[model samples]
Structure formats: structure tokens, C-alpha cells
Target: MSSLLRIVRFTRSLAPLYTAIIIASVLTSVAALAVPFLIGHATDTVAGALAGETPTGTAVRAVVLIAAAVLLAEIANTVISNVGGWFGDVMSNRMRTILSVRYYDKLLHLPQRWFDSEITGTIVARLNRSITEVTNFMKMMSNSFASMLITTLAVLTISAWYAWPLTVLLLIVFPVYVWLTSLTSVKWQKLEAQKNEQVDIASGRFAEVVGQIRVVKSFVRERGELEDFSRRFRSTDATTRAQSSHWHRMDVIRRAFLNLVFFAIYVIIFVRTVQGAFTLGEMVLLIQLMTMAKAPVESMSWVIDSAQRAIAGSRDYFRVMETPVDPRTAAMMAARPEGSRDGEADGAAGSAAALVRSVPGAPVVAFRGVDFAYEDGEDVLRGIDFELARGEKIALVSESGGGKSTIVNLLLGLYEPSAGSIEVAGHPSAEVPLDQLRSRIGVVFQDASLFSGTIAENIAYGRPEASEQEIVEAARRANADAFIRRFAGGYEQVIGERGLKLSGGQRQRIAVARAMLKDAPVLVLDEATSALDTKAEIQVQKGLDELMAGRTSLIIAHRLSTIAEVDRIITLRDGVIDEIGSPAQLAASGGIYAQLLDLQSSGDTRRLARYDITA
Candidate 1:
């Protein structure tokens, strides 16, 4: 969509404020023009007195009136500008809020692959620029452009009253100014685009270095990283200088022609005054009016440049808004009943709450003849068929890239199978509303992704309306209550970003508590304790047991011992199920599971069963 249209639509949302700003803008413009006219009248009165045609008293009264008019005009302009500035600030704040919410919603629904390919800092840079553009565009429309338009019209009309020929001459000059600016602005716009690209690159570089500071330090690569950053900085600096240099050259050309036009108007006025075609008062008035018109004319270049930047930034904003969200999630959103909060399914977290309350019992999860692949890639999972009966627990074991996590992702609807189908609670997974589907399942990942908030807040993430009592109970069940209480603030203790202030075990316990609070019918634990030490692992395992108990559980583990107690184990090879049996049964069969166990156990099944082994 066009940037102006987007800005106008945003303004319409807060019409009363913009309306007041518009009224103020017009008044300010009129008052601004009136000052010049008062000055011209004062000059004419003094000239008449000097020529002995007007009395000194009359000139003094004119000077007093001019002073009063100047004071009033300046006061009106100040008050109106203050009001317009307030409106601009309010509009800017609202636009930022609305755009941020939309961007967040888009991020939530975007495919994981998009994130894999895009840098977080680049997205942040785009959002920042886009929001600034939107706000500035509103300010321009309400104040700067409005004032210029009104003053231009008033100046031309008053000029015509003095001399129609001069008005005609101005009309001819104005379009040429606009046309030349438009032509020159195209190059500046291209430079602006390049400058924006450099900003994205520089932002990405900074984000990467900061995000991986530990890695850089550990590898003693600080110098190399700094050198890379220097390169990016230099490139960005060069682009900025190039853009500034081009703009300077264009400004000189524009100002030269504008000044020449102003001089030509002065010569015409002086000649007309000498020819007796215009009086001294008319000459003074025309000159002042022409001066008023000069400002708007000269400002045309600024208007074009700002508009172009806003247009470019708005296009970036819309690109995210227009990106396609996952179809299942979209369907759930569309199916929201009337009065649904934010048009989200159920309400804020209502889907999960309702799902758990309605059915506390386990829900069956099934995958039949499922074949999957990444976009433009070969199959990662083929002819996969499995079912976790209600309240049953199953383990998945395979090589690093052996479609183990792919299975979990497919069941969670993070990816669609190339062929076949998935079912939950006896309904086609694709047909089930995403809200209902997700709310019925809970998961813990290899890395516990935690937000920056209080401990209680993180625990209640899945169910925001969960009470303090419920949150405490869930934490206790997950073995997180002890550490939480150890902190000075207890439940209110702030956890830093991604729970970095907490250890691996602490973070995992919090994640388990979150899942428990959700009370989902099915549980999937993906390498939940893989990163912890023995002592931490034991603690986290207790929490896992509480979460998985009585739920249809799907467990994927790199450490075979972690899943030793599961009712059944499924082994995958080359994207297909190779074997399915109990751990003891697999050991007896002497297959892939047995081989993995031997690799870890030094050839004794008894010792291997107790020893941690890669699967």
C-alpha cells in the first residue's frame, strides 16, 4: 500500500486528535502570514509619514498596532504548535504500539525457517525505522506540510491582489521547483535505500557479536571479531558520507535556482514601482507576500525526501504484515467467536485453560504413513507410523539428524508432512483448531526458553490466569519451589533474559513447572535433561516424572538411560522406523539399540543399562 494511505488510515483511527492538530495548523499558518502583512503595513505607514502625507501620530498608532498583532500572532503560533506537537506525540505512541503488536503477532505465526534465515537485529532495525517513518509522516501531514500549503495559498492570493502578473510568474516558477526536486530526489532515494541496507548489516554485526560474546572470548577471537566489526563500520560510514555528499550537491542546485527566482521577483517589483504601476504600500505588501511563498517553495525538496523515506519504510512494515501465517493457526484465529479477546481463539490463554478443564484425561497422539521434508529438500521422515495410546509413554531414539525431532515437530504442527496424516484426540491434526491442538499438549525442549520476568510469571506463562496458589503448587510439583524460595523475592524474584541468571537445572525446572501449570493432556519431552550434570539431571528428572505421569508421553532423548523406563522404545534408521520394543527387548534383539548400548557400556548389557549412553 502507498505510505500516504497508510498514514491517513492511522490518522483516521485517532480522528479527534488529528482534527484538532489540523485546525491548529491552519490557524498557525494564517497567523504566521499575518505577521508579515503587519510588518508591511507598518512600513507603509512610516513611509507616508516621512513623505508628509500621513501624520506622525498615525504612524505611531500603526507601529503600536503592528506590535500588538506581532505579539498575538507569535502567541497563537506557539500555542498551536504546542498542541500539534502533543497530537504528534500521541499519534506516534499509538502507532508504535499498534505496529509492535502486529509485528509480534507475525513473529509468533511465522515459520521457523524464516527465523533460521533472518537475523533478529535486522528485523529490529526494520521495525525501528518503519515506526519512526510512520510517526514523522503524521507530524509532517499535521504540521509542516499543512502550514506550507496554507501559507502558499494565502501568499499567492494576496500577491494576485497586488499584481496579477507577479502571481502568474510565481505559479510558473513553483512547478519547475517541484519538478526539479522530484527528479533529483530519485537519486537521493536510491542512496537512502543503500544507507538503510548498511544499517541493517551493521546492526546484525553488533547483535551477533554481543549474542555470542562468550564464544568469541572462549575462542580468543576478540581481535578477529573486532576487525570484522570495523569493516562493517567503515562500510556503513562510507555509505552515509556518499548519501550526505549527494544530498549536499542537490541542495546547492535547488537553493541556487530558488534564490535566482526570488531575485527575479524583486527586480519585477522594483521596475513596477518605478513605472508607477504599483504604490509603495502595494510594493511592500507584494514583497512580504513573496517572501512568505519562498519558504514553502524552498521546502519542497525536504518534503519529497521525507515522503520517499516514509514510503520506503512503510513498504518494509507491510512486508511482514503481508507474510503468510501458518494455515492451521490462521484457521483457529478466523474461527474465534464474536467478542473473543483480540480475535484470538477463546481469549488470552483461554484455549489451554478450556482444553485442560474440559478433559483432564490423556489424549491419544497418532502419526500414520507420515513422510516429511524441508522445503526443496529430500525426505527427513518417511512412512512413519506410530500411536501413543492414552496414558502410554514411548521413547524415540535415533542418530543426530535421524528425524527424531522432526517427528515431535510434526506432531506439534510446527511442520506439515509431505504425505499422510496426523491425528490427536481422534481428529485430523490439520482440521483441529491450532488453539485446541496446542493447548492439549505440553513440551520441554533441550534449551529451556524463558522470558525476562518474575519466577511466578514464567511459571504461569501457559496459563496467565493461574492463581498464585496454582503457580506454587505447580512449582512444588516440578521441584522448583525450593530454589525459588531461596531467592530474596521468592515468587516475585526477577529472572534475567532467557533465564540466564538461573542454571540449566533451574531453568528446566521452571519450564517443567510451566508445562505442569498448563495441565495439558499430552506431554513431549525433547532432550529435557541433556545439558545438566548428574546431580542437576536427577533433580530435573523428578520434575519430568511429575509432568509425564498419566499423560500420553512422547520422549526423545540423546541419553538412552533417560528413557530406560519408558514402556516402549522406537528406533529410526534412514528416515524409517527400524525397530520398536522395550529397552530389554531391544537389547536382546542385538540391533541398533543394542549396538548403541554396547558403544556406551563396553559390551555388558547390565552395566550398559545403568550407564548413560548415546542413542
Candidate 2:
């Protein structure tokens, strides 16, 4: 079903509450109708009493009782509308919460290729609008829609009972009113959709400019950036203005039509009264009922328009919701292995495979003859094979785009290999549960994306259950404790967004501390020390050395210095392994490694000496 119909159907599911409110609301309308009827009856009777007919006590008594009934009806109307609004809000909030959680769950289970294909801003846009759209729909349904439907039904029923011909005339005109309203809605919905698309485009441009603000300022490209953003902003504003015009035009047309319709109703009623078909008192009742109905009829057109816009907004969100998630059933056998004595299990993996990894003894991560390509013919990784034993430390060194980070992501099961299979501890990577797999691994990235939060919270990010003392210990391990203590509130100090309040080195060290606190059996250090200062780099390297001592580790590095100390170096070029050997062995081979050592060692041509990494 279409989203508009679905929203309405879902609303109907809360029929018990709404039906009760509607029943009360209709009764209130009936009582209100009686007030005008009583006045008409009293008017006709007073004329009779004045014309020397016996004074009718019953008519006076009827008028007094109807007045009391009108007072009661006003209270009932208020009570019903408020209760309906509360129930609708409750249901809307429930739906929003459910959808929000499902989105995150689906996100984690999605294959790496899917995430790589979509922009981050687009995903954000889907989520941010879901709750807003649901809330808007609730307000429209229970408030504007409920009142109009009840009042409209009441008016038509009363008119039919008193004057069948007039009722039929009014009923016939409603269909035309509805058709015109739909026309306005169609025009407005197109504009609304266009406006939403423009916002997404503008947001993407803003994200790019702000993300690269440092480079823009340092290279004096701020003016160019501003110009690019201005161009995007102009497009956004143009679409917004066009959409605004459509809505305003619709508002004017709908209101004018309702007014014209109202005039026609009155002209018909007046002519009938002059012909003596109805008394003067009956004419007054007709005028009073129509007067009360003008608001709902006019407002109904706008409600229909809003319903269309809400449906358009919900389309993207529901599509994301409907996307399938990976079952990962094949990996279940290795998902959770029983811990052996001393928390170490026997592994079929090699010695260098175990360092800086999460799962002990048995390999927590591996890539076996893994081959990949963005497309069918263009292979990126050719039969790549590796295994991380429970506590092995390994480094991948290569030129730019050499597939070092790709290997790291494969271990994380972000992407499945196209030609070969990868297993985490002898199980197919795709078979393991996503959250469990992630919880077993921790990563320290080059850029070190830190959020605005307390130093303690940042340090304990991976392990939110970490105690205050544990957070402090992890910070001390990365040489971050001294600087953190210097902050005004120490662990309580809040870092600005993306940790802008902290130095680059400080943020990098804190990120390392977070990984350390996780105490995962696997660690992916992707250029972890590439962004730090010399002193901070030394401190971070020391922490990494300790972190790698007993877990599987994969280091993706551009800097030649970081690769010299690994148990073995896997050198890559153009996504293929160039050579794999110890630093001494590769240097002796006098191939790629020897040439690299020659360039990075002093300005001399001789047997190379490795840098003394004090950290």
C-alpha cells in the first residue's frame, strides 16, 4: 500500500481510543444541534403565545433544559479532543522509537559495499525526518481530522432530518470541494518533495566544506569554498521559494472556494424561507448550523494537503526499514567458542597471527585467499591470504591505495571477498553476528574521530562499563593521564565536538586509550601514530607496543619507520603482495624492502640500520 494509505490504516488500528473519543464528540455535536433547534421552537411558540394562544410551559422548559445540555456538551468536546490527542501522541512516539532502533540494527548488519555506496548525510536525513513526520501525522489525524469529520457528519445528519432537499444539495457540492482540494494537494506535494531533495543536496555541500575547513583556510581556498556553497545555496533557495509559492497559492484558492460554497448554501436557504416552505425560526437554525461548519470544511482542505506531504517524507525512511539484513547463519558455529582453561583455546593459526587480537588461542580474525574487486573484471586484491593467531602482531606496509586498509576492513567483516572466503577463527566471516564481531575488536584510526564528551567517557568509549579507575589506568598506559589531569576537571572535562578543544596529539592518545580499555583480542591500528607529534608519537607507540604484546594486531602504515619492528612485514603494491619477510630478511634480499630502507635510512648507500623506537 502507499505510505499515505498505510499511515491512515495504522491510525485506525488505535480504534478503541479514537472510537470512544469520536462517539463522545458526536454526542456533543448532537447536544449543540439541540440548542439551535430549541431556540427555533421557542421563537415559533412565543409568536403563538403573543397571538393569544395558551402559553406553552413545555416550550420554555425545553429551552431551559437544552441550554443546560449545551453547557455539558462543551465540556465533553474539550475532554474528548484532549484524550484523543494524548493517545495519538503515544502511538506516534511508539512508532518512532521502533523505527529508530530498527534503522541502527539494519545499519550494522548491512554489507560493506552498501555502506560505501551511500552518503552519510543521506542516512542522517532519513532518520532525522522519521520522528518529525510521525509526530506531524499524529497531530493532523487526532486534532484537525477528528474534529472536521465529526462536525461534518453531524451537520449533514441534522440538515437531512430537517430539510431533505437542502441536505441533498449540500452533500452534492462536497464531492466537488474534495476534488478541488485534491488538485491543490497534488501541486503542493510535488513542491514539498522537491524542497526536501534540495535540502539534502545543500546538507552534503555544507558537510564537505566544513569537513575540510582546515585545508580550505590553510590553502586560502575559503573563497572558492564559499562560492561553491553559495551556488548550492542558491539552488536550495530557488526550490524552497517555488515550493512556498505552491503552498500559498493553494491556501488562497482553497479558502476562497470554501467562502464561495458557503455563500451558495445561504442563497439557497434564503430563497426557500421567502417561499414559506420553512418558518423564519427554521431558517435561523439553518444559518446557525452552516456558520458553525465553515471552519472544519475550510481546514479539511489543508489537512488533506499535509497528509500528502507527510507520506512523501516517510517514503525514504520506510525504504531503509524494508531493506534486508544479513542473517550470517554460516558463521554461527564459530560465533561464540567456549573459553578453555586460562581463557586460551587451541588455534590452527600461526605464531605471528595472535598478537593484539581479541579472541584468544583460536584466531579471532583471518583472510584466506581473499580476492576482491569493485567490479567484475577489475580485481583489487588477488588471492590474499593471512591469519591472525590469538596474539600475533603484523603490519601491512604499502604505497597509497595498496589495499592495506582494505585488509583491515575485511578482518572486520565490513566487506565480503568476491573470489575467496574469510573466516574469523575458522568460521566464515559472514556467519557471525555483527555486534558480537565488532565487540570483539577495537580500532584506532588515523584521524581519531572523538565526540564532545567527558575525558573519562572518551577513554571508556568501547567499554562503557569500565570503572573510573579503569579509565584512568588506560589513559596512563597511553601517556594521556598527565595531560588529562592538567585539564580543569580531569576525567570530568568535556571535550568540544570532534575534540576540537584538545590538541591533535591529545585526541590521538585518547583514542589509543579507548582501544586499550576495550581490551579486545584484536586491534586494527590504521595509521594510529601518523597524526601525532614526535613526543606524543613516542608515547602512543609505547602504548601500542604493550597493546600488541598478547593480541592479534594489524597495522596499516605509510610511514616506513612504524613497519620495522613488526614480527613480519607484508609489503603490498597495487593491491598485491610485493614481499613478505622479516625486516632483516627483506633487507638482505635487496629487493623492494632493501630499496625502501636505503631511502629512509641516512643519506648514505650502505647496509641499513633500523630506527631505534624508544617508545
Best by lDDT: 1
Tell me the spans in candidate 2 whose CA falls farther than 4 Å from its real position.
8-35, 42-68, 86-122, 184-187, 207-233, 236-264, 292-294, 329-364, 375-377, 559-561, 602-615
Per-residue CA lDDT of candidate 1, range 127-246, in tens? 888778876876776667777888888888888887777788789779988877777566766777777777777787778878777788999999987887677667767767877787
Error of 1 at 134 (Å): 2.9
Which is the leading candidate under TM-score?
A: 1
Residue 486 accuracy (lDDT) in model 2 = 95
- Overlapping backbone residue pairs in candidate 1 total 0
Model 2: what TM-score? 0.83
Q: What local lDDT score does residue 479 receive in model 2, on the 0 to 100 scale?
A: 78
RMSD of 2: 7.5
Cα deviation of 444 in candidate 1 (Å)? Answer: 1.0
Put down candidate 2 lDDT per residue, 1-615, tens digits, no spaces: 277555445345445655654565565556556667766766666666566663568656755675666667667666765666666666566545545554564465556677776767667766776547755765567544655667677788888877776677667656766776676666666766776676666676667667667877899998886787577667767777776687677667766777777777888889988998778778888888887676666666666666676777677665665564455412322233221011111121112221222334556566778898874558778878766666666778665666878887777767667877877766676655555566677899888899898989889888899999899999998878999999999989999888998988899889989999999777889888876778778877887777777777887754566677777777777787778887778878876666777666655322222221112
